[model samples]
Target: MRLQPRFRRPGGPWQASDAVLAIPLGLIVAILIADILTPPNLPLGPLLIVAPTMTAWFAGPLLTGAVGAIAVAAQVGAGVALGILDMAFLAQVLALVAVAVLVTGLCYLRTRHIQELAQVRTVSEVAQRAVLRPLPHRIGPLQVASAYLAAEENALIGGDLYAAVRTPSGTRLIIGDVMGKGLTAIGDAALLLGAFREAAHRRAELPELMAHLEQSVCVNLAQPAEGGEAGEGFITAAVLDVPDKSPKVQMVTCGHPPPLILHARQVAALPAARPAPPLGLCEMFSPEYFVDTFALQAGDLLLLYTDGVIEARNSHGAFYPLTERVARWPQISPPELVDRLCVDLLEHVGGRLTDDAAVIAIQRTQDAA
Candidate 1:
């Protein structure tokens, strides 16, 4: 959803945040009172420019212009009350007016720039959603929930990506992280997600689906980049196939972190016995990919995440303990589990992450068993 800036509405009434305008207004009043009480030689009239200058910080152009006008009028009143209409007094008034006008114009430019940035952010979000479509809350016998955090400020998606598709007999899921971050890595991420969604339904086996993804990434990396040089990029990923009739999940890892299974208040990582190289470098390793099977009983929750989650560090440089943290809330539903983890992950990193993170939680319902 598009989010409007909270500073001001297009045509609606003023918001409570605007109450901060009183600071500048109060400064103007205080200056006027002090000017009246002090001697003429003190020349306090020059300080009135501060009112409009301060207003520019919290208000838009129109409100800033109003404050400027008030300051100018007060300067003139102060000059008359002091009985000093000398050229110096007049110059001080003109100088105050000039500063106020300059600040007001600057405020207008800043506001316009913010609006343009908001437009760009909205378009970026729409494109990200199209490339990394949200997973369904319920897919056959499995309940699913996913969350993503971008290291780049104001970005909705980055190197991390996840997607799921339902097949004739099961649900296929893929969670991957590109080798880089920000806009530079979005192309590879989009390519991999597109390939996975297409192959997830057609390919009958997990290894075949992964092979297709590897080929796609290889083709993408082979292309010439912006400077007409061959691109060099890779993606770490884990692909899983969970059949509706079986109590096990088939997984193939491509140099990615292992997923965790939470059951009976215990958490265990499901690392592949022999993991394949990352997508673009698969040709460098053995041509065959190994598929690992793990039991995923009813009431069991599977947690898939990028390395950013486990690698997140605190002030003391200690890594986030993903397994221990998840084991504490093993009984929660898929959505609740994901929501709580996202919050906790951000808090652990001091509310800002240094790397892109993506997480997915899938739970098998009792009836499906």
Candidate 2:
């Protein structure tokens, strides 16, 4: 029987932890019951702390805050009614309320801010979907995975791009970086992707398809900025073609950073034979863009990323250790590894990134049984 391969969807909504909420709810009920049984002399500090913390887990930050406030109020009322309301008890209650109020307020603000963040993410995602969108996990004989990080504080749009499509010859891939960041960068990325997608499918030669993309950029820059491609900024990119399912990958670069090859716990940049100036900067001269070949082995992983990831600066303004970090990741499924890397990378930056960054990991899977 022939087996149909299942593909994984990339870049979707973050699933809230049901356990994080459930545990808190259970703890709240248990603590309240214990409070009822033990009455006045109960040590409820742990319960109180857990109450506010639980609020954040279950009902989200807003609901968590409200729950925390209610818990604090209940504790105060119970203490007073049970005759445990001495001066010392009053100080403790005051302290509990103060802490609870502060925590809940912060959670509330975070929740509200997250809502606004969701809106921006939705816009950025839609902007990308209409332009670049997601790629199929498998194309003919190839298996693929991709990750994108928009370096705009909490915004989700970036100038980095990658695309793969199977054609008459074989599977062709385009990994490129548009100059600058923000909406304008997105415009340049979109233009390059649109032209490459159309031209790659129709044009017989790789050079012609690349030429078409450069032409598209020129035209996009010529028009009254649609979707924010202004000032005729250029983009650096690379295109790959693996014709006839050969073990060699033919590639052309446009002043972009070189991609890294990961094999058997070792990661190294693919050596370039010759490179060319970035797209949109071709008006002054006709640059000689050379096409080089690299050997591709099954089970090997190729990492194509824009400058945002490697160049991400920490508090000390130090660049992220990409080679060390990726090497540290366990060789596992694409999404799991990428998720871990994302956490590790963000933690290094103390939370979020400052520039647009994208990472595309393409792994060659052995032919399945």
Q: What is the lDDT of residue 295 in candidate 1?
A: 88
Q: Native-vs-model 1 lDDT? A: 0.88
| Best model per TM-score | 1
Enumerate residue pairs that collide in model 2: 55-64, 151-355, 151-356
| lDDT to native, each model | 0.88, 0.72
Count clashing residue pairs per candidate.
0, 3
Best-performing candidate as measured by lDDT: 1
Across 234-272, the per-residue lDDT of candidate 1 in tens digits comes to: 899999999999987899999899999998888998999
What candidate 2 gets wrong by more than 4 Å, as runs, is 1-124, 224-230, 330-333, 367-369
lDDT of 2 by residue, 251-317 (tens): 8888878888777878788756778788887577687767888876777777777787888889999
Off by over 4 Å in 1: 1-6, 9-12, 80-83
